[model samples]
Target: MCTTKRGKIVGYCANELPCCDFTAKNTGSCGTVRVGSSSSPSAVFQSPDYPDFSSGDLNCNFQFDISNVSNKGYDGIQLNFEDAYMEGPGFARHSPCETDMIFIRGFKYWQPPAWCGNLTGYVAVIDKTKNTAFLKVVNILALMSGFRYKWRISVSLIKRSATSKNSETEMENMENELYPSPNINYADIQPQPEVRQSESRSNHRSRFHTKRHAPIFSDNSEDEEMDPIAEPFIVNGEDTNITDVPWQASIRTFYPDSFLKMASKTINNTDKFNQEKEGCSMEGRHFCGASIISNKHVLCAAHCFHGMTKLYGFKRLDHVKVFLGETDLCEDDLVKYGRKSQNYSIDKIIFHYGYDDIILMHDVVILKLKEKIKFNDYIKPIALSKRNKVYYGQQAKSSGWGLTNLTAKGASLPTILQSTGKMFVENKTYCDAFLEKGWAASKSLMASYPKYYNAYESVFCTSSKNDSISKLVGSGDSGGSIIVFDKTHDPPLPVQIGIVSYGLDGLESKREHDNVFVDFFQSVSFYRDWIDLAMSV
Candidate 1:
């Protein structure tokens, strides 16, 4: 008989207590090892005789029940892997758990994959609602002498206050205090720009002109004297007020001087390279768009950072800059807006573990800012849509500072932010059909689309109802948000549903005349659990 204290097996009848009490009658076989409430809130568990080889074949199971703990309000369990060393994948590389592996359960949708080999720095969080969780370690190919495998995991209980649910509400309430009145007139509040009308029109004309059209104002005095106050031409979209889409963010990247020096040696055009170098040094170029999710965290496309790392040497945090609360990038908007527009440095970037560059799977990433943002009327975070909800055929809006014309030879960034008026969520079947046709016609797409294109549902498509060019997302809009209003709220709060991932124009074989203008966005609902987990950490 085993000794018991307060219904918890304290020790065996004769020997010292095991790491955990085995459920089976026999000493060590396949059975659950229950941890009593008397154990510390956080504890480290290790393989038998850790740091040394374990004799004979081994199979172990440990279970943790949060209900038995003193604190019933505990949110979840966090498993931090301090060390792990085991036999890796088989010769075929097909089965990662062919030899030795660790399996974790009770995380529901966020359950991590079976782990093997060196797994230092890995972390997994399991919700307490599941109550009971099991951690199993198995060694299938045990040697005659012994098995040389070891692992150390630190398990701790997490509090609900640290999770995204409360943090999101706190952030929203803090932002609401900054802007008491929602109907404030932005035009009356913002200062008028001091720029000359002619110069402003000239700037607009230069940037918006396409390769197919000659200069709107030529050397002729009559053309130059044309009414300067006339509305500046916009290709397909209209200018949007900063307050209307407060969550919009501009993700900029700067290349170091060392990188420019190396690039100069390879490029033949010294003049063009010199111009690019000047642009790289001053103000940093905007690479992608993002949406503010909280005071310190913003969401964007993972490809914006990963896709350019090789060519641009994006290894340092200092190279990235995030600008918020401003519509115009040309102005000293910080001084003009007075606390409304500010630039922030990134503290950390967390990408979805399953992100794939080739097929653009799970393309979203979260960025934590170095300083907490103070939200105002022109700067606020957008709420995320509920998980597993479908919003098919719903009308949504997208905003960005990307190029308005893709076919234009001398196209440049717009001075003001652009807004796609109303785009509808497209049918997945139709979008897939279009992609298949493109793949059949283009050899480049065929090479990348075969492995994961058909069954992938993590991305959704959007297109203009009238097929207007102005409503399409352009090159620099890769990380912007696809927002839909939740009518359930009294004021109909804007909820983010997607992150701009890629477009048909991203294809290598894309033609200027290609009428298909569908843009793909990383579905936010599908990854809501991952987002919550990331934010909690």
Candidate 2:
């Protein structure tokens, strides 16, 4: 009987009892097969259902391991594909990339250039620097002749004495060009602090303040009307249905004092305000929100990783984790409710080269997970905006676990994920008007922050859709998504347009105060090319 668990084919074990022959052993599941060992330094790996891989749509992965080598000067490993047959999507150079191809990873590049067609007799030699390599073959369409119907590969370990000096030199050169050293000096990595603000500046108040008003107009006339299916939907209150925004992710980082504190346990607003005036002193443990873009990557604001360094402390990757598939942080028994969330450590972080802590421009950052995330209904990537040009008046939604009441003290933050819809302002000019004039902070504070001076440069602004009770993004909402429905796809998917960055406080940032300011976000469309580069690497 076929064995299926967590919506995947585990093996072909009979009676669903995990039999040996056709069944994969633990660590041997997930479309993966391990090969090679110290005892037998060489082995052959055949396509799934071997010699007959064409029987059905095929998607499989094979991994070569050489970690068992104990010798001090072990050379490396070599992989040779014999009679390789992979039917790519099309004959065109770029089109075939979308089809049935064998993808190789853990090497210098994302995919090997040699495995594009049904050719045979291709060979790859890996260096000893890396202990693992992967090969993924995907064939989605039905049978197509002359395409890849089947294939076989040989994997063998190589000792220093096994290969000639010339071969070793060639492999070393390739490694240098493809995968350079992955060593990163953690101590040397420091956040680029705000340019204008000195370390002595008061953290409680914005240094730059401005008081100017300008007439602004909407550019909706140039906006391409969105797809009909992309029309807005309505939801009441704060809690959102899990299915509503599957791309939302909780971006959490460890702190000495908890950023999230209970109302009864929180210090008085006076005490907290006094602490801020000294420096950016933060409570231990804080969480922002983010948006998933791929199985291995999520998009967030740069500040999530490096905000208020002196107050929050210099950040490190070890303190960060990304949580997916959960709506409530208070729920202790998630599996019982059919909700299984996964936590992934940060493997790498790429911030926009132009990111500025002072003006907060180019605030986007891409986080790479240590392992690829398994996609499901509760967790998915949101599409990037496809429109080459800008648009206004389209209703977008923002979701996070931010404060529900600006007036409350420590009891303000919500335990459950909350979401609300807002409308995009026409252009940067229109957005700047509100940012420059409506903030409760003084003009001097806005001036101290140069990022506030040029509001339209790299950010987009939005206001609440519901007129009765103004909805705005607040602290803890930073890095969350601003999404719009995309009717381009079959069922119309939500495409992310912006990343929440910061909010303007209403008059005072103290307790019992409201921040009556339009929310600003880093424009996703403006950095599409940058996002693509970050994801590929």
Candidate 3:
């Protein structure tokens, strides 16, 4: 354990972990492993010889493994040049084909093989999100150019279904089968929805909701019928202030199934949400379900995100992949329909100061994008009622890639669509009517509508005729907008009147009044000033 003149280990390069030395790390030397005099170069050395056979034959199916891992061994990394996934790097096992008791080399994130050392840029992750946790390769050049090197990879995000120990048995006969089917690959799918003439567009359409439906929330006791004054805030129409509350961007995520009667949907009907047809992709991932307001600004729920600051030590735009207009989401289908999908990065997310939970301040957030998106048939923003006119029994579309009963286990990303439902706007006085169930009050589900409804400022409450069997909004779906159609306009316009706020639980969403939305806009309208100020700074 001799310290160097620099008071560090022999190979004390501060850049690498263990800080011993890349020389020592790569060397299978016993002296380096032990804390002996280790300073003598010759005595602390072992050869870094690797075999010609790697996990893959040649192509992108590049594979690798860690040597003697379960019993403690080496790690290796695979690199890729594109946005595709990595492959192999499975468990450490004895190589039957190779003699001399060869253990799997570099099973975890370790050294690359002696192949493909000339590749410039690449991504390194092995296996899918199912059997492995995808981690980004830290040092690309070092891993790719070093004595031990492997090929850079580009693969898909799809995972095979069978995860049992018998996976070898199940897959032995099926290893050649590509997952998600050749038909399921996003390669053929549309990144954006298709815009066709409402009639002709329905031709390729398989089956899904036509109209958007409100978050079907089940009544809860914690949701007390309260006065607007119960949750204090300033009132303004189009002119809203930024300092209306304090924690404007704090988002709260909920656990749907944890609570009873939270109106969290169970796998029952396959029609409203097709559990039988497709799978859930955006299941547990983070996405900011948002509403579009005037021009370029978008209003979304604050609790939908932690904001796009840090993701696994990388800076990612942690917002939803915005799709403007579309009937189908399959990128392939969009191409067939002649529809196009444009990509835009999120620039800014402005949450109102009044944002809070249980207690209302401002749950609404406004997003600024990197560029202004062009709107067309399948992609147009919903209209906002600067006034309190669009409400009650009036039908409109509400959509989001929200939770579906059982398909929660599937891989399809949540989506935005429209369904038909009624407006439940009533008098605040009506919320006081009590409905009781044994052990709890089952009375006046409609009461909270008017109870929290603010005629002058907030817009809340939408009801579907069949409350018994319908899809509803839950956790991650918050801050998403409710697209209200205004037939009164020339284009039969759709304007976003409500930003999905909160409810008793994750899946149970209660409508925040439209007046409340206006109030938030009124208070946050000062954001124009903030945006201009922030940009200048």
lDDT of each: 0.56, 0.50, 0.28
lDDT of 3 by residue, 1-537 (tens): 322321223434456744433222232211212111112111111112222212211111122222113122112122333221112121221111111111112223322222121222222223221112233212222121122322223222212222322332332233122111111122222211111111100000001111111122232323232110111111111111111110111111222344312222322233443322354322222333454442354556543432111111111234234434333333232454566544445565443322222223234445566677664433444334433353433443444444433122322323333222222332222211111111023234423432222212333433222333333343334555554444444334444455554321111223332111100112222222222222211
Q: How far out, in Å, is residue 371 in model 2? A: 0.3
Off by over 4 Å in 2: 1-237, 255-286, 333-336, 409-411, 422-426, 435-455, 505-515
Using Cα atoms with residue i matched to residue i, what is each candidate's TM-score against the true structure?
0.57, 0.48, 0.37
Using TM-score as the measure, the top candidate is: 1
- Model 1, range 1-537, lDDT digits (tens) per residue? 331321224345546654323231222333455553535566666766566434334576766545456355555566666665565544431233555666665432333335555445444455422212332221121211123466677777656445476654664454445433434222332211121111111110111111111222222323322222111122267788788889999887666778646655643123311223332323665657899998788998765664222233222466788999878766656555564577899776665544444445567778878899987778888888677877776777788877655443333457678886457777666455544443333334543433232224566766563533436675567778988765555445577899886654221123332334456777888767667766665
C-alpha lDDT (0 to 100) for residue 69 of candidate 3: 31
- Among these predictions, the greatest lDDT belongs to 1
Which regions in candidate 3 have their CA more than 4 angstroms from the true location?
1-286, 306-321, 326-333, 357-360, 388-390, 406-418, 430-459, 504-537
The residue-by-residue lDDT of candidate 2 on 1-537, one tens digit each, is 332221224345667665332222112222667765667767776665456544224456666655565353444445555555554444321233334445445432332232434434334444332112222221111222232256776666545342223332442333234222222232432222211111111111111100000001211222122110110111133787455677788776553345424221432233421222233322223356888876788888875653232223224566678888777666632643577777788776665533445445567788878899887766777767642546475666788776554332432455567887644443555555544443434545754543343335457776553444666665567788887664443344566888887543222233223223356777887766456545544
* lDDT ranking of the models: 1, 2, 3
Weakest lDDT window of 10 consecutive positions for candidate 1? 195-204
Kindly provide the TM-score of model 3 when superposed on the true structure, using C-alpha atoms: 0.37
